[model samples]
Target: MDLDDDILYEDDSGNESSENGDDQFMEMNMEPESSSSQKRDEVDDFQFEILTPDKIVSHMVDCIKEVNAVVEIPATTTRILLNHFRWDKEKLMERYYDGDQDKLFTEAHVISPHRSIVSKPKKTTRQTAAASSAEVTCEICFLSLPSKGLTGLECGHKFCTLCWTEYLTTKIMDEGMGQTISCAAHKCDILVDDATVMSLIRDPRVKLKYQHLITNSFVECNRLMRWCPAPDCGNAVKVAYSDAKPALCSCGHRFCFACGENWHEPVRCVWLKKWIRKCDDDSETSNWIAANTKECPKCRITIEKDGGCNHMICKNQNCKADFCWVCLGPWEPHGSSWYNCNRFDEDDAKKARDNQELSRSMLQRYLFYCNRYMNHMQSLKFEHKLYASIKVKMEEMQQHNMSWIEVQFLHKAVDVLCQCRQTLMFTYVFAFYLKKNNQSIIFEDNQKDLENSTETLSEFLERDITSELLVDIKQKVQDKYRYCESRRKVLLDHVYEGYDKDWWEYIDI
Candidate 1:
């Protein structure tokens, strides 16, 4: 199935457009409508471009040229200056025209192009040849060779071309550095320009790797670009402004442009990150232990019961106090009772029980949200496989005199279904830490409505269609999916409203 064969574009008016492309790209219409009709959904309406590797390189060159037109410096030097400012052309221009130019060049690790030099007698052709022929020892290899064989940067520290190639290769291949590679001379901070590195490195593999590293550095450092985080995907997204909004990659993987995780709606990036850390940690296991075990009253050592008797002894040799495990009180006070703890009614015992109950309750609450989150995630994974089933259904519908265009609604239904599931999955994470209030109750009600509708829509899609009921099934499926989309939007809009009005209150777990 050649799905995602084109890019999706969502304009400011919430309308969509698609173009046929050589590579796989899927456009997503996942943004929810704003609760207030007076305001536009600006979160996902920002300007951006989906760029391939070649396009990325072309764009970088275009930026350099655009800046070079005004600065009128060597393109190589301009590249160095741009890299210093993280590819922010506006910032670089401001600094260039309004600030100290020499300091700018110095901070970029390049010798100033306008530096003053004392006039000297120009050497003739014969004198130049004689000077080039004079042998000088290479500082690195300590080998004497003709001066023509040695080369260096503007800093005047010379090394053999062979040494320079090896040094650059190590920096490029071993250290995986390209944009920030410095001169190989000791304690020198001047950067080696791209032309110099390209000239020195002869290996095609190293050259390609160096080029890749350079492009990667440009994307990573540029505030306006983000590499699509999908596995094995080489595409990048370029935006006019940086914001925490959904970005659909050409690979059909949707992610948050700001944090690079899957596009999670309702739950902001901060809470999602905290929830992920909580899920990955072993703190829950420790909590379980705290609720189920008791400490030795004497040595403070933890103990778990393996026998029926309530009478217990501290295992520590230095302090073996006989105490009833049930109340953690001295056994001597129990007299001859060997099977029961008379001090179970003590204040300490009551407090300990209350603490254990609180720990257990908190653990159960976390699990409630975690299980729902995981269930939806697992369901979403399997939902992708539905495309194969959907293709078969699409074919079946076409064979039954239905036009190919008409059968596309099945595919659209599955897309909407997957998005609804995704949104429902994150609602649990938002609710888990939410402190109870009227606003939270309303959020949960919205969550419940969406969850119920999504499940019903999923079930409707999985039902087999027969020739007799084909027309009826199509109408039902369309209505169900439209309802699901509406509910999903409602849930999201309410959460967004909460964010704007500061209606959310959270409790620390």
Candidate 2:
């Protein structure tokens, strides 16, 4: 597939509008590709999907299938061989095809019971003898159990089910050694495979834990694979590029495929991580930028804004005074703590918006995204009126009060909500490298207005229905939601217009 397949154009004319930032947007005039062609192109790209439990099992089976096809071995033996190599199919292929077959099998702890005396390798004679033993002592717990109640790895080191259960449970739950748990036999270093571990462990929950650890090891240990860092999201990202760069997961997580951190393109992973920690460390330190740190005018000590209000009262007991959050001026001129001044003047706002070109400081843009992202996220909390509305929608659904999935749009609306928030967050990253010009100015202002309205809407959405201001809040929330969403559309449209029309002369370095 060509780059053009991934990137569509703006318009039929493919023309750039005039210098003025008005009535401009990407047309995306390309004719839609046929479904078959589109699917072919999708396959051409390195595609990744979140594998389900069944899919994971199928993936392992596929590996076994391919390994068997190459080596002509039993699928169970192939599974063990693959696990022994940490699922490195290439190494398994090379070793089995190009290297000594007996060495590979012996190292992997696999022995074919069907092999007769004539077919048995000299190296596997010891394994054959051990498997023929009528009674074996359990290495762990030093207990005598029936041979049928025991399991052994490639090394013929057998352990009773009770001992294996206890060992496996400890490794999975306490030691977190599920991926590296070895045979309990003294001086035996054979790594236990998932099937053997599951067979030995009786508890379904513990077996699941063991399986999860092995599955996670593929992404955790493999160079080409990366697990999404999002909380509770289980996604493995497999990219074609071997270089260190960002990759997006199916779960909406964009992370550095190389470093396993959030996308930080212009900065190195180490510095980015350090910067993130310096800004986000809890218990010891609060996120400086996200928390909006500014010096207290009275105390001259660093303080963070703790509320949505612009009027701030200094927490310093020695210098208890009120001041403006924006300019550090006294709060007295604007009485009743009701004054709004963070809305900077046009000239100051213009300068602040494009300050990235000169200083290359990402502080403002980072803060903007952090605040808006958190605002949208916090708005989704259970206490908010939005959830109440969602509850009503669910009740309507349960009672069959409405037909044709009347509340279906809620899912789409929330999806759009999250999408817009993410676009707003990443737009700043793009803006940080953009030239300070009319385009940047327009986009920045759009962002600022959208953010203001979003916060206002979030505030309104949080208001209790029983409150006297409920009607007013509802009206305000609706108004802000429309305005914010519309502005966001225009902002993204303009950016897409620029990208499609190739508007950038040179990105800011």
Candidate 3:
């Protein structure tokens, strides 16, 4: 019988049967027979078809080629393709044949061996190709750079370190980035991050160059500069050279040691002093002899001695009249010359009498101003007392749990009264200064009129029972009080705003 067909004939003790039955009988002889023996014998006797190694290899090769042909596959997918080719080749050979199949498997697993190979030479070639593709050149400095050396900002523009650092340093020095530092590139708003700077400065030599540009070439103040030490003076003090001692502030005021102004004893350097005298007239003289040189006390004009013995002549056109060198009086020849007389003594006496009269007139004016200032202060004290009384009453009313609307109305009233009182007080203070100094009385009289008007309006509001009347009174008081306040601010501004620089220098604390 055919191997694919069932067996037909069998013999056992003259009995006829199929070969399958005979085979089963023979299998029963090989082991302990069991109830499942019939099923086991049928299974052992069956024939089935199996795929050969060549056919499996061919299928795997076709699958790999199809996957590789697809464009833009991800790296993971590409890795899967390589792994499948390797795994299927080994699996096929294990199941069908156990001999070496290196050449057959190699041909099936890889396509274009030069391109798909993962050897060292192939990897090196790929890296070289990537480097060449990514190389860029700086636009500003026109320097060629390797792809890795280039840095891209948020704007997506790449720049070399040298050009970017120079640009940033200029911007920081000139237009200080007080709150924010934005990109220097035109129309680009990217803010520079600190990491970008650190990354670009990998080369030590390039980093040193960048630092020099930042510290030296930039116009920013050096660390040695300090704020002025004068109390309430917000000016900055800077010196050109750190090693050189700075000159003192001309106002004769001292500052902290770090403020670049320190007092030191003046040293006598002959040549230097002479040169300074030519350049600056205020240079202090060297010795007692130099100090005694005749200089006009009023104008400090130097008088040269010429054509006279033991006497100086005043050649100044304004003071050409004769004067004594000792006393600066009208020059009277000491030796009983033609000009010697007691008439000089009589002239001096008359001048002293005139000075006494002038002093009396000045005293009278000062006393009158002082009395006016005292009267103004008294009026202010009266207004202050009235305001304090009203404030206390308002506070008491608030603590009694009044309606919010009523409380708010009372608060507004109290606020208006307090503000009116402040305006009056400030005006009084300003008037007091003007009066005490015997200066112009116009400002004082004007302030006094405003005070009276404000006080009357405030009193009217307090006495008025109707809310409408009180509102009207409040509006009037605010208008009048605000006018006075504005005037006071103007006056104070004039007095304090443009103070002399020397005035600030004298602040001790």
Candidate 4:
């Protein structure tokens, strides 16, 4: 039965055509779904609002041209466009439709605008106040209303923006009052301390409103001068003419000439002496001066008078006194000559005298040591030259007398002479090395060892007996044996002792 059914289906051409048509329909439907999923993923990843109706319509036209397929616009994008234009389908289509397919394929997509995304203007309380205060008149020029404009400072003082700007720019540019731009009102020199002027000028509208004020024209008046802002004080302050520093008033008020807050104190004027003197009484002044007094060489404690000579008077409360020029001690009445006032102590005087004697002794010892060392070095050098000459003569003798026995004997003698010369060299070298190493005792001991070794060798060589001569010759040959035996003795004792005594005496001083 199954074989018969297959044979019937194969024979029917309509059945094959129907199956192929169904497969084509499925592929057509799946293509759009896959393409739309890809586009939606791309749009989701972007941060900007680039998926507007206009941009979508522009992209759709390009997609249609590139694919040459009936591209259905994304449902998300279609809904967004519909909502933006109040669901007006015809208007959305008209706005987004691309007329030329070739052009759409070449150009980039455009973004559509939404009514909800429009930017709104900013407003602040200070700006609102400034606008309302535009009706107020400037005291300097006596001008009123919107023609001159208004500038509201942080201190809440309002002025014509033109007048304030002109005054500030001129003072800063021409007169070099570049730091301050205070209010122009009489006795109201509050500063305009705004931190956003750079940003405020970025707006074209604000810049246009205050253009004249920014130029060089306005002049700062005395009205800009203010009392020091110090608490409980009512001192009037002025800007220093020579320096930019602020002058303080008697009431302790501090204001800069540029109309900024008190940055620092100004130099005291010479004319303020009388005013300062009038502030306190005689006894009060005397006490005040004493408390603030400086000790003088001619007098003792005296009040400093500004703009006067260095000469002073003693104003001690107990003794209103005078003293001599040379000495700084108290003097008898009408005494013109100097008096010796230095008190002497027994121990201190003794120490001073001892120090002087010690210094002299040290100098004498240093000179003696220096002379001794120089003479010793000269003697060593002379001895070394003499020994070297003797060595050359010994070498010549060995060369002239060629008998084997005699040569052997002369070689032995040369060896002894070489040993003696080496001893001398080692003594000098060891002395220098010990001095450098601060081991003068060891160096001196080595020198004494060399001297003893030389004396013993000389005595052994001078002995008359043949056996003694042979023993001396053998001893001279055995350098290592002699060295081992002599190693335990005080070699450089004398040199070290002398050096130690000299060094200690010099250092003690």
Candidate 5:
């Protein structure tokens, strides 16, 4: 099967219109949908797309910034809340609204060191938020310090600046705990967030490492997110729906957003995986001729029954025994061809017959679909060559002052051929695995119509037609393309509907 890289691709003639031959291509219902509108309706509806690592980091920073503003908390406290909520902004709101604010702070492991036990302290205007208060005890170093000696988190843990910095630096740099660090107290379990890491970690390299961890967590923890599978792609995709699906990344890599596998459509993901494993497992032993081997009756040597007559002589001369290849019995009773030996065992003939019939029917059906699918792929390659020739033809006609736009019909025809051929290839895949029922017949009829339309479009694209005929051929191609696309979508929708109804439930095994 020509099931090569199935990613939908374009040869980057960016933004070139199919109807560029003439400003007046032809009167046809060939108005292409706006790409932005299409993306908005289908892809962007999930409020996500693949983004580069830089963009992911930027998004992470923005989320932290937004939480900081709304909660009126320091960035460290905001990050603690965010991490506690698994980076879900809505869940953070839910938790914040679910109970007492103090409870929220306690659960997030944030304690305010500046809390006054007796009464609320008078508002002071002189110092910034990061400034440490004087007269604090440094618990880690057991030092009594004057003012400006210590900073504290909401969790009420306080330590001298030197101790806090060393602890943060050690956790972030040496222990690789930059993603999260707890309070400096030996027994404390309060998890410090990135904001605190930035404040306490003096080294720029450690600060950068902490930032990277916190930023990368945005994609790592979300259910509706994943890093792109392509090597060095460094992009991720997220969507509200977490179902198995193929998505086109911004980096031009098409992949399964769920498992990060290559795009495989028509076949469901589970079924495709089973098929791949089966192929791998049977790769060596599944050869038709090799599988037909038998043992020599006389010497017990393994022998392959390569196609010939039923009569056979043992290759093991030491025990030269003439045995029928079919029955593996002495040749005298089998006579010449031994046609009678080919009969199934009467004792379990019914069971054996049913299995053989089923296997034959399934194999025939698969081959029927696979051959047609491959034929379309081959035809598509030829159509691509035809388009190249059309390009050369247009170049030669440059002296006539006839722009490709005036002959845009020919170009559009080529586009239609490509689109239809691709559709036809996968349509067969969908058909073969589809459940056998009345709908199967209807689906087949639809497929047949699409195949006819595709072939008709292909003929138009390949024809050596006069310049005057370009418009008519173009119009025909456009109409056929639209029809074929409609049919293709209908078939795909049917298969997807089958999946929803549990048509392929056991396919994975």
Candidate 6:
């Protein structure tokens, strides 16, 4: 099967479901065995609902209505308050009820209609003349216009409708602001409401862009939500709570909701972020240089002795200090010798060699883990080919008188293999930063067992199959993949256990 068209989904219960239809890949009991474990396992059933742009907008409206029902405020103002609180209704309620009402509205950049009214300021001659003539001066355009031509927020900072359109358009299109677009009046912190934006902006393209910006802001600010990181995918996953857990998007992309990277378990978001930065940086290049190159003792300028004699001289024009490449000692001290320097056995020379070797060892250690990490990453990139090959195998098995459901084991095997590879890939990342200890040794052992089984399963799947040996191959493939799956779970369980027991220790990069 083309796995792209039939993407697999795993719910909180660990039962697998394919999006193409009701065909389940696997089913297993998820009930906790004891009451003590029930609480922990309950989190396994954590629910989330995937939302489209329209649904997200509807949800935002519902939230505004819900809060408005209790607070009895205008729906427009409620939206601003909800956004200010990052759509956290409970926290908004707590602050609204337990704190100063005027202060809350002030912070949210809105004038509270419920606030006590103050004495009105005396009108200027121009204001009186405008009031009498039913015309007002627009501060932005400096043009006198009819009172109906101007608009303003509750803060009473008014501007012409044309100026409002230009200002809102500039903010929405240029600055990419939606929910936080403040008033056009100078020094005015009052926000422009969605109703005002819709009423003023008539262009459909700008309106759609505004709506998109609003939806983006809603999802980005909400703690329980995240936009699927897949390219061109507009779906957002809204969860019951925030966590560093794996989330599969409707577009068939699986990623960690916390940091929006590929679903990397065993390793964490912080370490993965650090590792990515390390990989992107020239830190390893510097390490290689430190390990392979020698610096001049007199001027501390780095030099790489690619060839020639040991009587090395500093390349610096001002500080041409002569030194021996073998011991890095003064050339005068090795006058009787060419390649040999007696200072090679000296304390300073030994320390210098030891430091270089230490750097070399550190680089080698990083490469040991990095190479494996990169190998699995490259393998993962070509997993689609594996899936296509398995589809062919399934067809071959069916031609040998096997039923459709009977050949699903091939798909299951490939699924398990991919899962193992993914987990194994991140295990190397986890191991890279892990401090050596008994627990880490055990973790490494588990990693090795899983890796060996995964490679064996991969080999079995990639081997050519004949109709004569289909029966025997089917049994072996199933058994090997099952073993791989179990091993993967075992490794993950041990890592989770290490986390729970505080058995894992980490080293700073």
What is the TM-score of candidate 2?
0.48
TM-scores across all candidates? 0.83, 0.48, 0.24, 0.20, 0.55, 0.84
| Candidate scoring better on TM-score of 3 and 6 | 6
lDDT of 3 by residue, 332-400 (tens): 544554244343455543454354455554444434543553454465456446555655554655565
Evaluated against the true structure, the overall lDDT of model 2 is: 0.56
lDDT of 4 by residue, 132-159 (tens): 6657676556788663366554344556
* Comparison by TM-score, 3 against 5, better one: 5
lDDT of each: 0.80, 0.56, 0.40, 0.38, 0.61, 0.79
Model 1: CA > 4 A from native: 1-44, 124-127, 293-358
- Give the per-residue lDDT digits (tens) of candidate 2, residues 1-509: 11121111112223333422111111111223122311111322534444433344445445555677767754445656777787788987888777467777667665643344556546577766665555766767777665766777756777777777787899898877755676777766666665566445555456556556656665565556566788888656655454555566556666666677765433345544544563465512333332346666566787767788877888788988886766556677656445655543446434533442333334445555456545544644432345547566445444544443554444334444544555555554555456777777877787787666655654554444343443453455455666767877787677767766866443432
Off by over 4 Å in 3: 1-353, 392-468, 498-509
Sorted on lDDT, best first, the list reads: 1, 6, 5, 2, 3, 4
lDDT of 1 by residue, 17-44 (tens): 2323211111221222223322123355
Write out the backbone clash pairs for model 2.
109-154
The numbered model that scores best in TM-score is 6
lDDT of 5 by residue, 333-449 (tens): 655547676542443434434544555555565557767867987987888788788776566555455676765655666776776677667666556556667666766787787
Candidate number achieving the greatest lDDT relative to the actual structure? 1
Task: Kindly report which residue stretches of model 6 are placed more than 4 angstroms away from their true locations once superposed.
Answer: 1-43, 118-136, 326-329, 338-355
Cand. 3 TM to true fold? 0.24
User: Whole-model lDDT for model 3 versus the true structure?
Assistant: 0.40
Native RMSD of candidate 2 (Å): 18.2
Residue 223 Cα positional deviation in candidate 6, in Å, after optimal superposition: 1.2
lDDT of 6 by residue, 1-509 (tens): 11112111112323333231212210111111222211112236655667655456556656765787798776667778998999999999999998698899899998887977789999999987777679789999999988877898877888898899899889889989988898898888888876677667755456667767877888999999999999999888878788888777667888887899999998999999999998899999999998889888899999998787888888799999987887877888776767666545778877887888999999998999999999998987776578888898889889889999999998998888888889989999999999999999989899999999988988888888778877788899889998998888899999999999999889888
Q: After superposition, how far is residue 462 of candidate 1 from its true place, in Å?
A: 2.4
Worst 10 residues of 4 by lDDT: 1-10
